[model samples]
Target: MVVSSGPLNPKTASYEFNGISGVLGITFGLPLLCVVLNQMIRPDFYIVGLFTNLDIAELWNHIKPLKWYLTNKELWTYYLTWFGVLALFDVLLPGNTIDGVELRDGTKLPYKINGIALTSTLLATLTVRWQLTKGEMPELQYLYENQTDLCIITVIFAFVMAFFLYAASFIPLAHKNGKETRERILSVSGNTGNPVYDWFIGRELNPRLGPLDLKLFCELRPGLLLWFLINVACLHHHYLATGEVNNAILFVTLAQGFYVFDGVLNEEGCLTMMDITTDGFGYMLAFGDLALVPFTYSLQARYLSVSPITLSRPYLAFLSSTMALGYYIFHSANKQKSDFRQGKLPHLKSIDTKRGTKLLCDGWWGISQHMNYFGDWLISLSWCLATGFQTPLTYYYSLYFAALLVHRQQRDEHLCKIKYGDDWHRYESEVPYKIVPYVY
Candidate 1:
């Protein structure tokens, strides 16, 4: 496996977003985003200026009665349980550590593949619990009630992990030579001179605990599996609140569950993804995977749980088709890209770039530069739509997703252009558009 490395002095050099934007986003922006979401998802009518059109005076009246406390019990039990179980399951479940992309120093990081089992086991457990307690189940309602605690718990965990990783990166690995020590333990991009950025971006590429790859394990399991579990809880909560499960709620649950399932099944595909290959494990990924994904990824479901709504069979059919089309494009595009990398796609091999890497310019790759991103955006839109647009919070998923994809695509193209140089320009000339076919 080619240990893919970035340019020697490439233009798309930043990942920490370390400057003003990076620091603010990590230190302030992320936590604030979750806080606002948690405030908006209250079961009793909550005044959310982000969502509702109520005035400050009206909002003040609503919030004045509420007592504010920061201590979190559910997050500790729930998040820790999930994270601990993930670590345990990674061992109990049968999957070998597959070698990841080759590092620039020629080291192949090994990753364990047990996501499918993890997801399936969680679903089975939820099912059996639900069956055991037809009406006595309390965890679902408790989760919905104490989401704020969950949010805080993850934030604390993410920051603590970030500090520990940053400090640990400085620990000297015993080696024959100083150069070998750096290569084996530290990362190239994240080894920037700045301490603040290094901490945020992560100095070590892959820190492990015993046989466990903490970076890979945290990113894939825990929060992600919890996301599915949360959806299950939301489904239960919705049913408990309302006598029947709304078709819209069911659709969102199934879509999200499928999304998680697909990721687990196609996790090998994830190795080739920019996140796994390019990103460093730090507060960004830590918060995102451990907190953002599990808590906020199910924003639509949370909203629906609070405010139940149902769409017609016809509308449901249309929405299903839209999501399916997006998933089809998403699944197929990734498969094509993966197959091309494996030399299964005959044409892509001939279209070699100057970097000795081949560029795909056919099939879905021929259409949009980031077809998978487009598909993700479309599916995200569908998930938001499942909540029926009563509040702005319902649309938050698709809105944030759009901004995220656009920024990520731009970042990717900038880095790719620097790496591929003129070949990327030529490919851009052929592709022309970024995401949409005819529109920018």
Candidate 2:
């Protein structure tokens, strides 16, 4: 009878890792495995490990002797053993699932996996790909004779495991929730039929286009990631056969995890699934944020691996700093608003003059009503700049993100105007300018 020292409790095997711990484990373990796999298989693909004090060229020159470890067959076997262990542990851990309603006819929907679970599976495949490719694709002759069965089996296994884990965890979660999502939805009353009917009838009369319908669309649903994932698999078959996964594939697999995790943590944005569904454009836009930008624009490694980024390290670092500031502002402002709404913090009225018991306008929100958005744009610019001075495709994502946020802001303003009436206008007057401070 022995007790383990790890976070997982042996007494209750059902226990799992908390959010931060689980994320940290994945972050460290998964990337390390990818790097190790690469080193073992295609040791020629380099790492730019610059210690805080060391210079880049000096470090690269220093590590040149250890390069032989890359081609060692035995090293790869060692790496794969660990990779398999982590991958199995990741799948077996039984993570959180999102259980929403089946809006039509008040039926209960079962637990569908939240985004992080789905994204992890994609990353595992990329890990396998980089391992197999070892940096170069196999010749067609070798593919047919030695490795076709292995490739097929790997692909089928990865797909089946990802799907199985997702279904197993999510279905039960949804079943347990039992129509709560539906109740939240149905509680909001409407008479002009569904969103389509409301759109046609209300367009002429309302002009501003009030809540047309409450029904969340299939396209807007995060479940649509399954479709995008399928398409990616189809378009890149050879990568699987040779284990030479594309650089774009790898970048996207990582970036998507960031997007999904961000959405989950914010939590309020999840409610927006129902909030903006009637706005077909908003729905499309959300899909773009969750899926397209992550998959497409982050394709920098695939296209520009050979190209040189014109920006210097310091400049990029400065840009990254500015972006961090923006995220701080955006996140801080949102936090303040949430606190005020939840009554966790006392609401201050103005920046220079704090009217008792109102929102604190002195911090990030003090600069402007939507200063957070400015910070967001700054951060986005930093990311876009890091992609090198390449074609617009790389930067398009940031641009689209800005446009979407602005549009969302406008929508929020309109909704506030209708709901808050005179209070919104008064609030606007007090907090002049939107997004950028003193500029717009």
Candidate 3:
């Protein structure tokens, strides 16, 4: 989801796909993929081996009890409770109000940037609860054991929330002149005149409830915090199962935990990012920020819990270097772009476009148009590699991430081509790479 912030070009903003089929496939396909991946990564299943053996009987036996995965009232309760608490915290917590990028209407919305404080408070509260309960907190192991159910619940919630947002978009704001006007800002790309398509792509640019921006809140808060908690739960589960925690599990837990923490710490950066700046708040984002991110991103840690793999010093060193390099590139490139946008890097080499925007051609942007994407992919690779080569299913994060980033890069480039036209071509010619420098 990390991408460079581009100018708010309404003409460039549109539905990611042209037709209904692509939308339908991803809408239905993603949830199914999540289920399949989670199931295949179980200790008993050898996902790679299943391809060669083709155990239809065993697969059918496993699939027959699909009802078991559906019935988990406790999980539903826990998820709802957690979401509610976070929403409450988002509203009540005190933080600096930062104005976001100027909109098509020439107005900048103010967003509260209290993510770090909220994360700190939430973690402290959870730590106290765990300590006071003497590890008897049912929610701890319950999350790990009923992960499938939790994921299902999250998916359902995303659908419900998306529907609610879509329906809310039509509500009219009462005016003083006995007139009704909808204050909802429609996304240029998402206003496809088709309900289903718009619903999937998100019709509203920024759906809010009072001062709480629903899309922004969801992007940084619930799913990300839950991801870290899930990793912790998996680590605890591993310890409970095997008298001690393995280095592999610990590495993944810490790595992902730090990533989530750092994201929250720099929460203001998201205000200018593509999600908030251009894309509409829809089911695609809701499902991704909620179900896809937490459940799937923590797969490596989850897999380690069931099948622990102790890494040798050599392997650990390699993974450490890989993750470090990825972080360095990702962070530095993003900061460079952000600084350039703010006019803080005037001396840096850039191409002045016809649209009155400067396209960076130096620093990380010089290396690749989307170097941050490559770094992000590398980080994902390290997480999967931490699990060793035991199961191909564990590498799903890196594989899917690569595809997602490539699609995003294509989308960004298409938008830039349309917006900047000849200037974009000149910039591209100068940069000469999309994501991997000479390798690309």
Candidate 4:
């Protein structure tokens, strides 16, 4: 489906957030929550009696010193180097070029689909580095040892990048006639006339550095690849501690690794998602892509590294089946919708919207408006379940993801109602569910 118009000017567009209070809450609350969740994953951090006898002093003692947060020079250098390598690979690797959905400006941005190639190259490079250096590389070990520091640095970097992007958005761009203009260039959506809100939500739809699309690159590359790498580090740490690989860590690593691999392999699919097609690049995306994703999403593997669990044959079978089923549903549902949009499934039933877009009502979509979310949730649950309930923190990803998807589904439905009007009501009437068939 085509976009109705270009990005709304931030100066003139309606506010998306509830108000300054809502914006402040998300901007501050999420990062603080991320830090708390990371700390809660520690093996010694007990949560059983916290509510009954909360100790403010004890909690403060657990927090690292201010100097500690400032002193991870090697970790900082390693992160910057990793980002540079990925950026290099993004520019150097050759892949099929796919055009993104048309924006309000009547132009489609061409995106490079070399994520699989980049993933393969990084793996091969790491392997070579290990063999050549006789496994002397301390970077992975550093990642495991100083995860908290790394997370802090990532959050800091996200803030820096967000500020830079927000500032850059106001700079005048030269037009084809060599005249400068402050008008919306591509599609922008986050201008709320409030600096803090705009910074958190984003001011530019697609921020680029020459040919590199920062949002798309971050969405598919660093956070995801680093998430897989963090899992690898945790697996390696577990082996070092126990002198053998356990099925628990192995399962979590491979399961999440597969998810990341699939995402990178099919990176082009993201071009049609809301992140690429709609949301502006800002602190929200930056923090999510850079900090929350790699650090928090790896909680299962991280927890297993410190507190390993042995899965029985039957339990292993169950978890494996769960993951496989989730993957099948998630992948197939998404593919069906994508195909329908591309007009490859002309036989599918759809509701004709007034805006010339068709609301799909067949196949997986017929089951629910977002069957893929159910599948995705299942996958997350399996990951958490593999951790075996040592601490509730390991389940954070699944819980957070479910809430995020539900909120996103609601937001999307609201937009659809506005865009399609009565047609959306008809479509909803026919489908009769949002994310679960015969349930939600």
lDDT of each structure?
A: 0.74, 0.40, 0.83, 0.83
Q: Summarize candidate 1's per-residue lDDT along 65-164 as a digit string, tens digits.
A: 1123234453466667767877988877876568887766566767778776777787787778778988646777677676766676777888889988
Model 3 lDDT tens row, 1-440: 22225433233234566568889998989987776666766667666565685554543343425455457566667998999989989989988998988776567779988987797897788789889978656677888877776787888889999999999877864555867663656776777678998899888899888768999999998999889989998998877777797999999999988889999989999987888887889999999999999989988988888788899999999999999999999999999999998899999999987767899999899999999988988888999999888667788889899888888888788878888999998998888888877988
In candidate 1, which residue ranges exceed 4 Å CA deviation?
A: 1-18, 46-52, 55-75, 174-182, 185-188, 348-350
Per-prediction TM-score, please? 0.89, 0.47, 0.92, 0.93
- Candidate 4 stretches greater than 4 Å from native: 1-14, 43-72, 135-137, 175-182, 186-188
Residue lDDT tens for model 2, 1-440: 23223332111111112333553464345333322222221123232221233333432331223244444454345334433443343334455544343333333333323335434655576567657977342332232221212222222233333233222221222234565421112111111233322221111101111111111211222323332332243224435545454433333333443433465334334433424322322212322332343234333332233232444557645765766676777677777766665667655554222223343455666678777678668766765665555355446557777776787677567655665666666677777777888886
For model 4, residues 331-353, the per-residue Cα lDDT tens digits are: 99999998998889999999887
Q: Which 10 successive residues of model 1 have the least lDDT summed? A: 59-68
Model 4 scores a TM of 0.93
Candidate 2: the clashing residue pairs are 110-174, 111-170, 111-174, 133-243, 323-379, 326-375, 347-358, 347-359, 348-358, 348-359
Candidate no. 1 TM-score: 0.89
Q: Looking at candidate 1, what is the lDDT of residue 91?
A: 72
